[model samples]
Target: MRHHIVHAGWLTAALAVLGGVFALYVHPDFLVTLVDQIWSCF
Candidate 1:
């Protein structure tokens, strides 16, 4: 259980940093356009 909890903590921290970087480097409009392109065939 302790090991699982420690792994979860590290996972959360990694996700937080990934999210911060994405927020800084990615534009919402670009993401929106990408999603639109992916769904256009549907």
Candidate 2:
């Protein structure tokens, strides 16, 4: 049980990273806009 839970956690994190990479590849400008908005908030 614990082993499966650990594997699931890693899998989730890996998926999240892959999703982010896909987003970056598909929308490089999105991160730039996001950072601009975040900096404006400060």
| Maximum-lDDT candidate | 2
| Candidate 1, 1-42: lDDT as tens digits | 999999999999999999976985667787778789999979
Per residue, candidate 2 scores C-alpha lDDT tens digits across 1-42 of: 999999999999999999989988799799899889999998
Assess candidate 1 and give its lDDT.
0.88
- The lDDT per prediction is 0.88, 0.94
- Give the lDDT of residue 9 in candidate 2: 100
Candidate 2, which segments miss by more than 4 Å at Cα? 31-42
The residue-level lDDT of candidate 2 at 14 comes to 100
TM-score of every model versus the real structure? 0.60, 0.66
Residue 30 in candidate 1, Cα distance off native in Å: 17
Predicted structure with the largest TM-score when compared to the true one: 2
